[model samples]
Target: MAEIVNLRQARKQKARDEKLRVAEQNRALHGRSKAERQRDRLIADKAEKFVASHRLDPSGKDEQ
Candidate 1:
């Protein structure tokens, strides 16, 4: 025999779960300090520059 469930309660629980998920994500993204964020930005920028420097040009001529 299948157990009966209340649709209204289930819907409310689902909404609560979704809200909690979003809140957790927001905390992770916004919890960092200014210095920590700046450090991460600097590291990302350095990695981007490094990759760009090593990338090859599609055309035959080398870009000055």
Candidate 2:
């Protein structure tokens, strides 16, 4: 026999989950403008170069 669920609680949980999902989607859509994306890309590129400059050499020959 299957356990019984409280219908009202189940409905409320479903509603809450749906609301959270919609809010997340809306946030992503309106979160960043084009200029923001460009700025993020620039910042990320700079960070990458900074980290790469401090890295050790690969020191292994390719097996190709």
Candidate 3:
């Protein structure tokens, strides 16, 4: 004997699972806190400054 299956319930369950997967992806993309964002920005700024300080000028004159 074959088991009875409900097509409507199966469709709804599939939709719910798809929604959950999209929500999880969205959270990963935009889930950073304000402090975390600021910290990342600060680190990037510091790195840029460090790189600039180490760069040499194209002209013969050197500025420290």
Candidate with the greatest TM-score versus the true structure: 3
The C-alpha stretches of model 3 lying farther than 4 A from their native spots are 1-10, 58-64
Best candidate, lDDT = 3
| TM-score against truth, every candidate | 0.49, 0.48, 0.55
Q: Candidate 1, residues 1-51: lDDT per residue as tens digits?
A: 999999999999999999999999999888888999899999999998887
Can you rank all candidates by TM-score, best first?
A: 3, 1, 2
Better of 1 and 3 by lDDT: 3
lDDT score, candidate 1, position 62:
88
* Tens-digit lDDT track of model 2 for 15-39: 9999999999999888888899999
**Model 3: how far residue 62 lies from native, Å:** 12
Residue-wise lDDT of candidate 3 within 1-64, one digit each (tens)?
Answer: 9989899999999999999999999999999999999999999999988877777864546777
Better candidate number, 2 or 3, judged by TM-score: 3
Question: Against the unseen true structure, what C-alpha lDDT does each candidate score?
Answer: 0.90, 0.88, 0.90
Higher-scoring candidate on TM-score, 1 or 3? 3
Error of 3 at 12 (Å): 3.4
